[model samples]
Target: MTAMSPTPHDPLGAVLPPSPDNELDTLRELVSSTYLNHDPSLVTIRAGALFARLKALNRAANHATRAHKQATADSRQEMDHTYLGLQNLLYEKRHLEREIDKCRQFASVYQDIPVHALEDFMQIAPEEAPLNSPNAKGAPQLDLKRKELIKEKEALLKESKAQLATVENVKTHIDNLMKTATDVRRKVNDLVQPLPTTSEPGQSTPAS
Candidate 1:
């Protein structure tokens, strides 16, 4: 049923009573969707941040999906429920959406598969916009390079220490060789000296 158009004269506007023709069907459809109407049994088990993220993702995914389907629709303002799923998908690597399981076993697959094209189309330029966001596109590669440099520096430091130790050992060997050479020179000088007593004996013989 068509929604009664808002009129200028009616101070209260088109206050159409909640009927099957208009409001009732809309409510029924909303209730059927897990994102909008959650089962009481499931809500009981909700715990921690993950549960909250899943719920928000479920709702946001639905909003984006619908918005996409109705490409020409001028959706109402203040209808930002779609952001819940989008931000989670954009930031988190993984999440479990309980609502979208009925139709699409994996409801929040968008989180895993970032919609870079959509984000670009929407001109969303935040760092966490999507995997394809220019800001984050090269970060993972840079991180890998940084890790490799750290490893290389550590290896070089180890090699330098080994080289220094070898140089010290060589110096010690050279000092020992120098001491041995000095002792040999002193001993040769002592053996080559002439005897002083021989001169006195020769002089006495000449006199006789």
Candidate 2:
């Protein structure tokens, strides 16, 4: 029998010692009894069991992968929602800040202007009726009072004018009466005076 030379690719042959006859016989007997003469039905049953176990593991791995993906998606969605909410809040904060800044600017610009309490303003300001509210109770009262004052003033003026006319008439009548009395007195004095005696071209001496 010719011995086959070890090939270059046979790494085990280079390191291992030569097998004894007893070891070689034991190996051959194990192969023939366990593998070569094994039952076909038993091998098929074991293979089926192994294949079913592999399929179950594969299914478990797929389910775990799907669950992980779903969890990641939900987490990402939650993060996005939180980010949007934060952005909205930040925008509102900025808007409020701008409004506050404008208010401050306005206040600074008008700082020198005087401010009055509501009560003080109410006290000093003129009372005006509300627009388009002619039927308001207070407005009607004020209008009535003003009308009454105007009517009273007019009545007073008319009375004064009539009194002035009456006074003028009395003064004219008094002046006429005074003139007539003076004329009567002058005529009585003239009539009461003795007539001047005149002697025609004669000198008469009378003792009185």
Candidate 3:
């Protein structure tokens, strides 16, 4: 008994792959199978399904691209804003530093005087124009007046010192005079007191 050949649907024969017994018959079968599946509606339906899937994917990709672009733009805007703020801060810092340097320069210009004299100097030289202008002819007169006042003060101080010395000398002389008067008074009291004369024991007779 001969063994039967494998059927077309046999799993083992399909795995092994059939040898070509008839090339013409195989070609005819391929054409018939292709014709059977060539339904226009079926092809259209599959093509439509594939197109829909691609459209959905493209839409998702477009949404993602737009979101990414928006996020990038927002980040760039934030960075620009931050950079602008930094620039403003830098400008302000430089301005403040310049102001501080000016203040330091002003302070240095006035550093020669004692701290206590600044208020008096400010009172004296309140404006630069008055100090620099030579047209203020009264300045010379005022300066002369100031010099005379200084001379008067010096003369008064010298006179007061001399007067103080004279007063001290007078006080010393008065103290010495008082001491001399006390000594003279003591000497007068001693001279006025009578010396006692002693009489002998037997003379009792004469009354004066």
Candidate 4:
């Protein structure tokens, strides 16, 4: 006996259950068989079912395509945003590195310069009187003091000059007196010289 092929209603060869992998082939065979059997009612019913299935499949495919396109666009936008963020980070890192390098250079250049602590500097620095204080000497007071000191110095200088001039006059008078005494002594010596006696011929002299 010959074996019979499976029909649409008995698609498993009457021994096994139908599988999803062969469903399209089974449908094709069913369509062909219906046309070959020339049954109008069966053809009309199967055609309607096939058309509905095709429409459902088309709708599902269109939805999947739209979802895929939307997902791709979203992924691309996210990637762009991430790339921009990375670029910004890199730029900031470079700027920071440059700033650090400049700081290092400055440190090396000024290495030998002294750096005083704030407390030490403050301790050594001169303190100013408060502006609001009643007795605080302002610029006008300082100027007045300076003028007084200058006037005193000028008076002292003039007095010193006068004293110097007096000392010079005294010295000149002493020098003139010394010269006059020398002249007088010379005149007295001339006047007091003993008369050279011509008693050499007489041969007589008075004893003192």
Best by TM-score: 4
Candidate 3 colliding pairs: none
Quote each prediction's TM-score.
Answer: 0.30, 0.36, 0.34, 0.41
What is the Cα-based TM-score of model 1?
A: 0.30
Candidate 1 segments whose C-alpha is farther than 4 A from its true place? 1-132, 195-208
Q: Model 3 over residues 16-97: C-alpha lDDT tens digits?
A: 2122223324434544656566776765565555445544444544444454345445545554554555555455545545
Of 1 and 2, the candidate ranking higher by lDDT? 2
Write the residue-wise lDDT of candidate 1 on 1-208 in tens digits: 1223443222121332222223323434444655346765554444223334434444544443343334212221112333343344433322222222222442332335433343353476655557566856665665566566658756655655555555455455545544544443343333233212212111333565
Scored against the true structure, residue 146 in model 2 reaches a CA lDDT of: 55
* Model 4 score (lDDT): 0.47
lDDT of 2 at 96: 49
lDDT of each model, Cα atoms only? 0.40, 0.46, 0.46, 0.47
Error of 1 at 113 (Å): 32
Q: By lDDT, highest first, what's the ranking?
A: 4, 2, 3, 1
What are the C-alpha RMSDs, in order, of all predicted structures? 55.7, 65.9, 59.4, 62.2
On a 0 to 1 TM-score scale, where does candidate 4 land against the true structure?
A: 0.41
Task: Give RMSD (Å) of candidate 1 vs. truth.
Answer: 55.7
User: 132-164 in candidate 4: lDDT tens per residue?
Assistant: 455442545655655666686566556656655
